[model samples]
Target chain A: MPKASSGLLSRSLAVYFKDLRLELRTKSGLNAIMMFGVTTLAVVSFALGQSGLSPKVLSALFWIIMFFSAMSGLAQTFIREEETGTSLILNLTAEPNSIYIGKLLFNLTLLITMTTIITPMFFVFTDASTDNILPFLVVLGLGVFGLVAATTLVAAIISKASVKGALFAVVSFPILMVLLMVLVGATEKIFDNESLSAVSSELQFLIAYVVVMTTISLLLFKFVWRE
Target chain B: MWYKLVLFVLMSIMIYFSFALPAPQQQIGESSRIFYYHIPQAWICVIAFAMSMFYSIMYLRKKEIKYDDKAAIAAKLGFIFCVLATVTGAMFAKVTWGMYWNWDPRQTSIFILLLIYGAYFALRGAIEVEEKKAALSAVYSIFAFVTVPFLIFIVPRMVPSLHPNDSIISEDLKFNIEGAISLVFFSALALFTVVYIWLFNIGVRVQLLMRKQLEEEDF
Candidate 1:
């Protein structure tokens, strides 16, 4: 028999794969998030009409699209568990930390898929363009991870609650506010084609935000997961 | 009961010194008086939040109802003072900066703090099961307080803040603080802390009463 430590990685991976399989079967989480992203992008670009938009506006708009899109569906990760009556069985099988890691991975995958589809569409539809792809992607990557770490735990909390709708945004906005602020600042620099030196501080802040959020969530998840 | 008398005395002293004794500084003029209320309210907000998180950790470790009750009351008071800080700070900003809402990084950070605890209450209100409500909110309080340091300290440094009141409760360290003003400030802080304790005890009593009534009804 494999010891728990020996199987920890594979255990989490198995949970992740299980989520992936379920996601492939229904794709509801993917569809809702993507549709919201694309539709919001279309509306925003249509309203602006490709004229004299500033770097700050473009950067802010990009996150608003991504942020709202995320809010639309991320809670469904744990909500699905409750709704489907599988949470109890899943609860009995995997360690709480492993379950949390799996749910976080699943949420992150859904976010990535939605962003991948919406990101280029954002630049295409809107007049926003970034000259520095690498730094922008770096910020985007960290920002997404921060959002995932922050929101995934929040999603878990709300999943158990009766009122899920507004609470997610209320709880998540505070944690994400710093992340979104730095991302917008970094993205504005990317828009202006500024050197990495320009966005270095914001990037560092994002890295810190990510580390702090994930650490806190990991510590608190054990309490949140169990009865 | 004796602590209540002490709270009353502290409140009276805090009022007199804050309203009458402290010398108003130049540049900002008379409006600077807002600093007394603003600073204490913000401190209460921070301290109360810390207390909530402490109780949250306690709840998680002990799984006790009383710990959850302590956590809940602390957070609720924290949220109340968070709003007070925001409003009082907004008024202060209006006088100093010519607008009520400057989106100062400090203001924005406080705004974020408000939302975090607001979500805490919302989470509490959502669950019908008593134990689940307590446990989930305790967990969330811990999660939310984790961001307070980032919001209050790191965010301001990251952004070039125009807020004159950037210091997080550095009122004592100010060179501008005369002995009189220092007396007032410390007294106000003591008063606010007592007020918090008073409110916290009241909240716990009410919670206990509610639980008792529920038990009686079940019987």
Candidate 2:
């Protein structure tokens, strides 16, 4: 058995590759998430029939897509670990801190990838475009950073929960509310061709939220992960 | 017992002086009276959460059952304070903002606080084994406490607030007086702290009593 942590990046990369390989082989969590994303986008687009899909509304719609998709993905991140009973084995064999950081990094990657795939779909389905794509991506990326950090932390807490689904949302949604606001504000700016600095307040908040959430989660993860 | 006596006295002074304090310089004149309970409730909610986190750390580090009990009690009390804060805040909002509910950061965060702690209790109720319940709830409590400030304070402040961001504390304290009213607020804070400790001790004792009864039944 190969030791996972060659270093932080390699270790996280290793876990990411392992999860990706397994997910690819099984075609389960990721597939479910992607299908869910597509159905969600389609349903939302059809639901808004002829409302003219204004840029502001498109921005909000984009975030709602990401939010629901992230929750569906994260809820299973640990559920799979638990199903295989790999959580205990991992706990015994590896450093708990490394496991947390590793999972967080992987979840971040999944969110970024999912958002990457969905952003274009969101663009085509709605009336968004490539003109402000880079700035829009930047805002989406920052918001996802906050989302992954907060969700992974909450997921760890809710993972052991007996009543899982409702409980996870209860623990996560409130904190995510801030990130959602910033993401929406930034998206609006991107669509309007405004400077990223125009939504600088929201940007600063997105950064602070990611920092605070990650710091606290790292400190508290060990306690929550303990049997 | 002594803590309770002191608490009662402090609470009496607080209630008595609340009726006597001068109205604050603002639009929400008579409604400002709600702060006499509202502010203290919110502050204690924070305090209870902090205490829960501190005990959580101690329990995990020491693997002590007593620390677990302490954490559990503090969390229960924290939940009570969170509810009080929300209720008092709703009353104040109705009087000042002309509505019982608004999406003000303060209001939103407190509501979230209630949900988080509500989930905390639900987690505790779901687990059946005594030791597992203690360990898991301790872990969740610590995480939830860590989550609260971010959810309740930092996030809300990041966006604009309709509620005035004016200072409740001193802008300049050099000449500030230890007036009768300040005394009342401080006293209320002191009283709440006492009530918290007493309630916590009682909770631990009750848990112990229940455990012994269960043991007797097992025998």
Candidate 3:
């Protein structure tokens, strides 16, 4: 074992690798999330006939997929440990910040994979047009950061609960509603071919949301992490 | 206690003012009366949530089991008041705007607040382990409150809202309170705060008793 003073990054990375290895072997979280994301996209695209979706509605539809898919899977990081009776082992082995960061990174990877597939498929299926590609990705990046930053700790909180799955959405939607609304607005601006400056305000809000949420999660993780 | 009588009399006076006072002419029509009930319900709802958050912080800081009881009860009462606000606000919307669920910024924000607190209770109900439930939920309560400002203030400003700006903060709301209505409004505010505290005290007592009973059961 490494010295306890190996620093937060190394400790966190140790946790990250542990979970990543387990995840690769099990593939449960990724499969559930991807299945939900793609299935939602397929059903919605077929129902809406893949056209006539204004930028506004298309933006909303895209996020609704991301949101529900996230709802389906993001809690699994903490949930998996609890279900496998490894929560206390993780708690004892890792610093709380390390565990939190590790889980957050795991969630980030899942979200990135899901969004990468869903965004292109959504654009093709819904024919959602974007006038500015770069700003859209920036907003998407900020959006995912803020969403997982808030939910990672919340996922830890709900992991102990009996009603884990539904409770995650109930808790998360309120916190993420502000970010989602901003993303939709930013997406609308991007579709209108607005310049980066036009998207700056939404980007700013997303940045603020991410910072505030991350600070709170870092501060409170110890309380939620241990029994 | 004398405080209970004070609440009762003050509540009666507020009701009288809500109905007996002349309605505003320009916008609300007879529906202006709803404000007397609606605003206080929403304000108390906010007060209850704030109180819950405060106690949750206290629980974390002190690690006192008592703080958990107080926090849980405050959140429960707050959630109830929030529902009352949404329902009354909807009724007011139906009368004034001719629709029940308009997704006005104020309405949407409160709905979000409702969901947040609902999750708090759902969380409490889901965890059977006593100490773990208290610790985790207290942390969750504090974390969840970070969004309250954005949902209530920033989001409202960003969206084009059909709900008027609160009369207390901005004159930009559909109708401004002046003269007699102002007196009634302030009185209702005072009455509601007192009533909220009174109910909160009862709630803490009841939660403590329930906790004691559960402990005895375990023995």
Worst 10-residue lDDT window, candidate 3 chain B = B165-174
Query: Which whole-number lDDT from 0 to 100 does residue B75 have in model 1?
Result: 86
Q: After superposition, how far is residue B186 of candidate 3 from its true place, in Å?
A: 1.2
Single out the weakest 10-residue window by summed lDDT for candidate 3 chain A: A1-10
TM-score of 1: 0.94
What is model 3's DockQ versus the real complex?
0.73
Write down the worst ten-residue block by lDDT for model 2 chain B.
B166-175
* Best of the candidates, TM-score: 1
Q: Candidate 2 at A183: error in angstroms?
A: 2.5
Which ten contiguous residues of candidate 1 chain B have the minimum total lDDT? B166-175
**CAPRI band of model 3?**
medium
**Candidate 1 stretches greater than 4 Å from native:** A1-6, B161-175
For B1-219, candidate 1 gives per-residue lDDT tens digits of 897897888788777777786455655567777777888899999898899989988888888889988888888899999999999988877776678886777778888888888777777888998889888988888877777777767767777643455552244235386688877877788788888888888999999999899899999
lDDT of 3 by residue, B3-61 (tens): 88878888898888778889844444787677777788999888888888898889888
- Please tell me how candidate 2 rates in CAPRI terms: acceptable
Q: A2-93 in candidate 1: lDDT tens per residue?
A: 23565677777778889889989999989989998988988898899688689889999999998999999899888889889888888878
lDDT of 3 by residue, A45-148 (tens): 89997568787888888889989999999999898899989998877788899888888998999899888988898889887887688888998888888879
